[model samples]
Target: MEVAIDNSEFSYLPAQAEALGVPLPPVERLTLPLADGRTLSALRFGSEAPRVTLLHGAGLNAHTWDTTALALQQPLLAIDLAGHGDSSWRDDVDYTPRTLARDVAAAVEAWTTQPQLMVGQSLGGLTGAALAASRPDLVSEVIVIDITPGIDVTAGPAALREFYAGPTDFASRDELVDKAISLGFGGTRPETERGVFLNTRMRADGRVEWKHHFAHLAAQALAAHDPGSATAPSVLHETGWDDLAAVTAPITLVRAARGFVSEADAADFQRRVPTARLVVLDATHNVQETAPVALAGLIESATPARRI
Candidate 1:
């Protein structure tokens, strides 16, 4: 489903001051076939140009990077990670970075001939690291936002956990919007409301449910008898740091001041990935949503004049 941007009520901007005279880039919802037969859905900005690829954090879709994409004003493709957004859910429940990276690598290989600048947030960040490590040819530069393998994986955003642990289907859209606002999903009511609208779909059963599959998979994992079962892959597997270290391209780590990655963790990350440059922002976990302008500037600076 497309986002409603023409309406005044839905026109709440995150970094409006920075995007003041910039023309709104054209956005198109696209789906690409993967080698495994499942499809990867994405929001493509502009057309026929070297692009920047964006991967949103778990429980989020391509729309999460909408403001940042707009601020950048460059060709971009923001994809919905497998088991999240409009992408097909994996029955095997293998949401590991390697598994998700394969899908993204396929999409990248199919979409852009030149290596693209990759920016990923949280779970997406780990996936980006994995992709760069495994297929360095497809990515020119890597920017991981607010995620490090060193951070305690067992801990997650409390409000986000509570929000996801709640009911799946809502009777009314406003009810879901209210729940999102109460859970502190977005700062303003309009922004929160728009986020709910972008991430939900009306089922044939006449109920509104989240478009992403993370919550459902989380519930399934929680209910599973065996933690090591194929249905619930270990979320804290020790491969991310290795992947981060393997990347030879230019790397930038964007950390949120009030988010998960601590100062010590950042230092450890730099120690592990010697080529990584760290930039801390005064935001929360979702830096793309909270600080689009600054994040965009960092991205633009990290992106080279031409991809090799």
Candidate 2:
């Protein structure tokens, strides 16, 4: 079905989409293999910005960046993220941000030749940071949206449990969409935004599932949040705060002002990074959806000039 962006709700469709935003690509698909042997499905908006890659959060696939990617006006690439969307997942393997970070790194290497700008949300954000630290050259800049090493991570696992405590079987795509509306966007969303939400996959079986493997992901996110974990992120004000100290590229912290990331922490993260900028939107966790105009303005202003 052709998705419509309307005023009934979610009035941020192409009607309002910038006249000069980056061009989008024709229909295409790729199922690339990851190090663990699992295949990941990804989409490319434009093949120009050999250095631009956008990563989605846990439970969400690359589709989450569709609007923002277009707004950024550079060559764009978004992945379903292994075990999420169309990508395959291993039940027995431990799913950690570090592991997913590796998944993103391999995908970036396969897709691009020059350094890349990694823009990731939540789980993807942590994974992106790890990537910047590991493959400093592969990354041109990093944008961690709505998450920080210091934010309360338990929130992720709790939300994950609520989303995947058990199977949510549905007889049709409509039924699945209803369930998704309640779980993801806090329900009561306008029909316009529903267009975007329905884009999530619906299996042939009578089940409505998110793009990611919730079972293992829930466990991994819980571990990442554990207070006892040695790698837990430090608060912005804490001493020796250097989350991305090893990262040589300029880092930009995009935040949903009203989202999971705390304001104080956002400032601290910006201060911690050597060459970084802080951009916050009057939005919920989903800034790309809530404040696309505000976010687009930020990206247009702060994002480094891209190369063809």
Best model number under lDDT: 1
Model 2: how far is 130 from its true place, Å? Answer: 0.7
Q: After TM-score superposition, what is the CA distance of residue 173 in candidate 1 from its true location, in Å? A: 1.8
Q: Could you say which candidate leads in TM-score?
A: 1
How big is the positional error of residue 27 in model 1, measured in Å on the Cα after superposition?
A: 1.0
The residue pairs in collision within model 2 are: 84-211, 84-212, 85-211, 149-233, 170-206
Query: Looking at candidate 1, what is the lDDT of residue 196?
Result: 85
List per-prediction Cα lDDT, in the order shown. Answer: 0.78, 0.61
Model 1, global lDDT: 0.78
In the range 1-308, model 2's lDDT, one tens digit per residue, is 11222123223334434553544443234568766567877767665544667677656676666576666656667777766666776555444566666777787778878777787777677777778878887887887778877765533434445544434343555655565477774445554345434344445553444445554344444456542322222212221134377777777888887898887887777666747787777898877656656665665564567632
lDDT of 1 by residue, 131-197 (tens): 9999999999999998898764433556655666546778978997887788766768866778887
TM-score of 1: 0.87
